[model samples]
Target: MYGEGDNQVKALDEVSLSVNQGEFVLIVGSSGSGKSTLLNMIGLLDRPTNGTIKIDGVNTTTLNDDKISAFRNTKLGFIFQFSNLLTDLTVLENVLLPRQIGGTTKTANKDATDLLKAVGLESQINKRANKISGGQAQRAAIARGLVNKPSIVLADEPTGNLDSVTSETIVQLMKSMAKRLGQTFVIVTHDRQHFGEVDKVITIKDGKAFEGEDDPSTASGKEMEVVA
Candidate 1:
């Protein structure tokens, strides 16, 4: 809901869904279909006008702002389209930033290094963020997102700024890392090709959510099958 009375627009209407532990869930929708809103809701970045969001059995809507922020820092990780790294920071430092903020830097150095290695950015760990290529920076961002070992990771068009090849690589890296670390991932992407290996596919339309694939006889369904 964005406004009052006639100006009100319901970005999401009765949209309900769930992701199991270690599940890789993909959310897709055409423009203005409210997929991002759904992600924001699930990510605890936005509170719903009417409804509840439970992450790791905690009802987020019930928490105060301070508690919400604390919970978010500890339980959720995020990767955006852009790497959003500080130019002056090295890849390793950038990845350790979150741990430092959370006061959990005791083993952060080792954890960050291992995550960068997993994302194939071990060689670039000492490079300043500004010196890295777009793909390498995004890989570093992935490492940063996983540094805290959060329960769930939320990514919004994480590969939107990359080329097709890099996009594919990033997606695969995320999937593999999720499986290896047993972390749940909820991604909002426009790339249909990602449908191939996900545990679940959720489509958003007219502010409503429809889970699973469409009818096989439908054109979109056929396309999904071919992509998968």
Candidate 2:
């Protein structure tokens, strides 16, 4: 709801959904749809006006501001449409930023290194974020998102600015991470070609959510796997 009385606008109405642990879920909708809004809520960037949000069986809607911040730092990961890497930081440093803020930098160093390597950006770890290619930068962002060993990663249009090949690469990387680490992923994307790789797709239309079925004819490419 955006306003009061006659001006009220309900972005989402009676929407309820859930994702199983380690599941790769996609949320698809058009622009101006409530997909982004739903992502924000799940990522703890915004709170719902009504209804409870439970993460890992804990009710997050009841947490205070300080506790919510703590939960976000320790339990959730976020990837946005843009990489949003800090311009002044090196790739490794950007990936380390979250841990530094959470006061776990010293212990999480090796984990950060492994994550960057997993994303194929290990060689570019020392480069300034601005010096990296767009795909490389996005990979760094992925590393940052995983550094905390979060249970769930919430990505909002992570591939929106990339080429088809790069988008496939990014999605594959996320899928690989989920399988290897048993981490859950909830992504909002408009592309349908990658649907076959995910366990489920939830569609949002006019503020309502429905179980989405992917047609085999609409799916493209073989499901990607991480190479050893």
Candidate 3:
């Protein structure tokens, strides 16, 4: 909600959905459809005016700012459309940034290395972020997002900046990694091709959410009950 009186607006109106552990969920909607808002809510970046968000069985709505920040740092991971890596830092260093901020650097070195290797960025580990290609940079970003071993990883149009082939590759890599690590992924993307790979597809319209079917093509017509 924003503004007052005549200018008041509800960004999200009773939007509800559930994401099971180890599930690959895709969120699709047009611009200004509240897709990002829902993601922000699930990522704990923003709190709702009403209702509760339970992640890994923890009710985040009741946490104070300090506790929320700590919980977010430890339980939530994010991958954006842009890699947003530090240009001056090496790939390895960028991946370890979260751990450094969280004061958990003891085993982070090895964990970061392993994540980079998993994402096929091991060869570029020592290279400066500015020197890597867009795909490599995004891969590094993926590695960075998983460095903390967060409960769920939230990605916003991760393949939006890549070519079709690169986009397919990136999605496959994400899916494979998710399967191997048993990590849950909630991604917001415009690419319909990704629907085939995800465990669930959520469509957001006018601040409302609806669950889709298993088959991507037939998902639009079939809607499931929204879970609060």
Candidate 4:
């Protein structure tokens, strides 16, 4: 991207990443390091400036916006730093909205309440979206995303709004749920401590990805590091 003709920025340059089912991957990068840009590309929120993205092993750049949106609704889930709940609606209503709009499920209401319970919010089921803590709101957002049982969940700063302790709890809850549902998770964050549950942590630097050996920074580690 160009700030001006004389000052252009290569937000993401030749970055390739591959994720498999039931894998929890952490993406770490400081601000302006193209972390969110990469996430946006993967989330199908925006097309890449160059290169291509494949979901379910199908190339996506050639698909129209409606097709991409449909694919996203059916195949991918999204969690942002903010919960983005509809403040006027109840938690259950907010969670059910996606399925209702997409015509994906006949039982979104029941699924919403069940997901709320899973997130430790059974009593808050009827609570208005504005009446919850940040963590609770984010949990409700999680429920919204999973209402479709998506194949991949892309989270951009999923725990950015909460305190460190709450962030840990929230991340762990997500990890446990991903394991149970066999969902793939890709999370972007600047903080590094709470990712002990992640399978791998890939770092972005200078418009490219960090590549090294083991996650312990060793070459002999069993897991192959992908970002380069």
Candidate 5:
């Protein structure tokens, strides 16, 4: 419900789903099928008007504004359609920005460097956002998202801006990291080719979610375990 009675939009209606620990889940839907709304609710970026969202057994709907923000930063990572890196900052600095904002220890510098290397952005660590290709910029964004050691990573159209090859690379990188770190990932993507690569696929249609190979009109969500 977004506005007053008559103007209200029912983005999600009694939508209930669960994502297990260390699972990579995909959510697929049409343009207006409430995919983004679902992500926003799970990511704690928007409050649900009806049901509760529990992350790691903690009900997020009960958290206050400040607490929610802190929880989101510490427990969840976000990747959007755009990389959203600060143009002025170097790639390495952008990856370290989250720690800076959270007043974290400087020791994370090594981990940040390691993440950059893992994303194949090691050589471009010192370059500004303008200096990198779109794919490289997005890889940097992935590194920045992981710097906080979030329990769950939520991505909305993470590969929407890239070519097929780069998009595949990004998803593969995320899958690798999820396995290595034992973290959960819930991503909203429209690319069907990436479907079979995941573990379980949850389809979103008309504000509802269905499991497995449900409908062709809906984007098939797949969840896959990261193989070491």
Candidate 6:
């Protein structure tokens, strides 16, 4: 539905693609290339003005806000640049926050503890979220994301605020869990230095996506049959 009007921003144009249930997807592009908009749509935080978005075989635009929120609570996870962990809560408490929104806050303590341990933040569980370092806080956020056991994890520049070493460490850690849990991940990032090992990279420019491994000046791979 993106064509010709002033209100129309071609955030995603002719972008037809599908990501598998257990794959790691890297979305790379410089700023204003619709990377954030694409992630938001994929994460169910925003709806596209045109085009269909399906997650797990269900088109998301048809779902109402409450249904969408409930679906996301159970089927998707999110990690972002800022941890967004509550300052008044402890690490464990922050990890348990999603449960509150999903109305399962009563017995989620055990699950929160497990997720915290999984993210290597067991020792920091009792510490206030605000007291942790940026890296540690992001780890706690990771724990929070997994608390609901979503099938897919969407991260928008998850390491944007950290040093190179910490960023590398955190990315690997998150990927390890994503692999072990058999969950899908859509990562939107500008850090080209960490591209070699990515499973797949899709580059977007002026709202159109160039599929396959990230290659500029080469033919776009969109016409090729995508396996997933």
Q: What are the per-residue Cα lDDT tens digits for candidate 2 across 177-204?
A: 8899999999998876854567877777
Better of 5 and 6 by lDDT: 5
Go through the candidates in order and give each one's C-alpha lDDT.
0.85, 0.83, 0.87, 0.81, 0.83, 0.81
Best by lDDT: 3
Looking at model 3, which ten-residue stretch has the lowest summed lDDT?
219-228
Candidate 3 residue spans exceeding 4 A from truth: 213-228
Q: Summarize candidate 3's per-residue lDDT along 80-195 as a digit string, tens digits.
A: 99999999999999999999999998999999999999999889999999999999999999999999999899999999999988888889999998999899999998886754
lDDT per residue, candidate 4, 61-142, as tens digits? Answer: 8889999889889889889899999999999999988798789668778888888899999999999999999999999999
Q: Rank the candidates by TM-score, best first.
A: 3, 1, 5, 6, 2, 4
C-alpha RMSD in Å of predicted model 3 compared with the true structure: 2.4
RMSD of every candidate to native, in Å, equals: 4.5, 6.1, 2.4, 3.1, 4.1, 2.3
Backbone clash numbers for all candidates listed: 0, 0, 0, 0, 8, 0
Q: Top model by TM-score, which number?
A: 3
TM-score (all chains, Cα) for each model: 0.92, 0.91, 0.93, 0.90, 0.92, 0.91
Candidates 3 and 5 compared: the better one by TM-score is: 3
How many clashes does the backbone of model 6 have? 0
Q: Give the TM-score of candidate 5.
A: 0.92
Candidate 3, residue 13: CA error in Å? 1.1
**Candidate 6 runs further than 4 Å off:** 1-7, 223-228
* Candidate 2 lDDT score at position 123: 92
Candidate 4: misplaced stretches above 4 Å?
2-4, 211-228
24-60 per-residue lDDT for model 5 (tens digits): 9888878898889989988898898886788877888
| TM-score of model 3 (CA atoms) | 0.93
- Model 5 misplacement above 4 A: 214-228
